[model samples]
Target: MEKEQKKNKKPAFVAVKGIYEIMPAEFPWWDRFLEVAEGVSKFYNFERIETGIVENADLFLRSAGGEGTDVHKEMFFIKSNKDKWVLRPEATASVARAYIEYGFSRLQQPVKLFYFGPMFRHENPQAGRYREFRQFGVEIIGGENDPVFDAQAISLASRILKEIGFKDVVVEVNSIGCRVCQPAIKKKIQKYYRTNIKKVCRDCQTRIDVNPFRVFDCKREECQEVKKAAPVFLDLVCSNCQKHLKDVLEYLEELSISYELNNNLVRGLDYYDRTVFEIFVEAGSKGEKKEENASKLAVGGGGRYDYLIEMIGGRPTAGVGFSFGVERIIEIMKKKEIKIPAQKNKYKSVFFVHVGEVAKKRSLKLVEELRKNGVGVIEGLSKDSFAKQLKMADKGGAEVAVILGQREVFEESVIIKNLKTGIQETVPVEKMAEEVKRHIK
Candidate 1:
């Protein structure tokens, strides 16, 4: 009966499906990505901002294109006593909400903000995709609808990727037109898809009526031909949008940023208008053999959302921003085998080895004191064997070892040993930290 009860005990659990753990071995890659992202953001004069993960469900439902879109279908709802809330599917909408709720508009014309955090969406996971993924994003909001801000936003995204080992990024840009011209463009897209409606996917068939722009975003093979032949909005945008797009392109050229004029690059979100862009890189980068059908991965993208602020209850505001999927970017870095620079220590690092209970009791204090003097130290206090402690020190790459046995502890002296040369010397306990520093150096 006791054995049966033991057998019935539950097994150890694991992380939820599609959730990934950032193990210690993978931290260097993450560090490099975040370092470049944050550095570039600050260099570009953008302030950092973080918003709560849980926000009102209606916040996204209203601004993220309502029902039927991928975001709408993939949200994870949270039970609450008050209004419905959800884990944010993206950051831009939350940033916009913060801009309005915090009254950021009262201070400046356009508030520039950047963020790095996790976003949630309940979707089928694949390589480089997860139920919860991290994003490094930026937002430019509240200013006049100047096109230069659009170019600057794009430039910032491009610079960060390039600095973080992505040398072959191509910016695929397009103009989806504003309210003034979208209606006509929509009609043209709808009419084109209507004739080929039977050939397209069921989703595209529905989108053609609900939002014809989204049909351009379909990946269905059946809809490819239909979408390719659909009307191009670039040719039909109003005079204002045309000039805006032209100005943004010229700024990009002036900055020497490479870009392609994509005719079918309407973004997935509903808030974007006037300018939309996506950054893509070939899978064969870093001298890898190129395949004829090597599909490009979109590391990041965003667009101008002039009406997003007003749409979400704030006064009229123009905003343009972009976000990079941290996982996708890191995946590309690993594929390229990009090396992260090793962390440098000005002072040499040493290992602390102690034997006997008395020395072990004194080991912690010595380690802390050495640290206070700018000496890097690794210690094995729980390790009772002197030989094992030294082995651990060598494995940790420590340059020197500080030995403290019971006799040395009582005598007020310690042994300083060079790990590489195997040289040894006895020093006063007060000078042990300094002696180790000197030898390691």
Candidate 2:
């Protein structure tokens, strides 16, 4: 006890700030989620990529748009005495940075990559949100501005939902259009908001001049009225935007991808172009045992970024990606009562038992020898009573308990007792490894 006390004990993580950890209890659910994400990705030809968390704040400010979307408005920026940096607000923008820096275009067209990591945003913490939250997402870069690819990314987002036992995936899709149609839409939207500025929320009024489309995205009651009457770009999409959107829908129909047309949908990013989409919830509605809150609960979203690569100083390569919030997925899983697999027993080998100090000391050497030979052994060397030692062995979930005493240690043999069958036999210590392997099989 004194020797154990002399060693420095690991510090307890007591009162960990925000949302993050690596502990034994968390492994089952995390492993399950990873297994599902990896399986779905492998089934769909997506490889993995990990990007560093710290980035230049301008990367998000320029690419996510000057518009005060969640990323720009709530990013966690760090200004040191020497330099300025920011934690990543989302994965796709960083993926775009990786695409531009690493020359992925030289290797393959449509470089499909998967990512799982944490993103930081300074939103008020809620049921599905935290300052530090994780995201699991995939991106396909170095492709042409194809509507089929837009539909494909949305389909992959839905595939993850289904793989994670989500009952229904309601995809809300729209086309935010290209440079030509988008400017006109912004003009008309600003004009309309200009007249009814008093009726709009304070944020909407500010966004009227800077980011009027985001005014439609507001959920406040006053903004809802503005959104209800706002000019929709879907109605004013040009010939090229019209055909691309139509082609995207046609591909969805061809691939049997189910979705709803939400003309009001403007994703919270600046660089998005043409088709955009969000995956929502419609759970427990198949039969009468349905949920009262079976409405549109958004879990994942993404869209086309025809100008993102260029926005970050690269060639005019189109990129599309989808991101699912890990915490939100966990919240929904809890609400839907998803079952995580239990951890299996780790005590599958022999438990060493001894009577006195000499047997106990010698028992340590034999225990180490067995372990060195790839055997799992549990021992209570300080324990002198047979009853107490066997009790510890029982609690370990060991299949068999090896009994060693001063007599057995002197003979250089051990007694193996099958806990399940209560049978005993004497086996030489040198042959114990082979005997235990047989029992294990």
Candidate 2 all-Cα RMSD = 5.1
lDDT by residue for model 2 over 272-386, one digit each (tens)?
9888888887644334376555555888888888899899899999888888887777666656767766544443578888878878888888888878877788888887899
lDDT of 1: 0.88
69-170: candidate 1 lDDT, tens digit per residue? 677889988875577889999999999999999999897778999999999989998876899999999999987999999999999999998887776778
Report the number of the highest-TM-score candidate: 1
Alpha-carbon lDDT, every model:
0.88, 0.81
Question: How much does candidate 2 score in TM-score?
Answer: 0.84
In angstroms, how far off is 230's CA in candidate 1?
1.6
- The candidate maximizing lDDT is 1
Going through the candidates in order, what is the number of backbone clashes in each?
0, 0
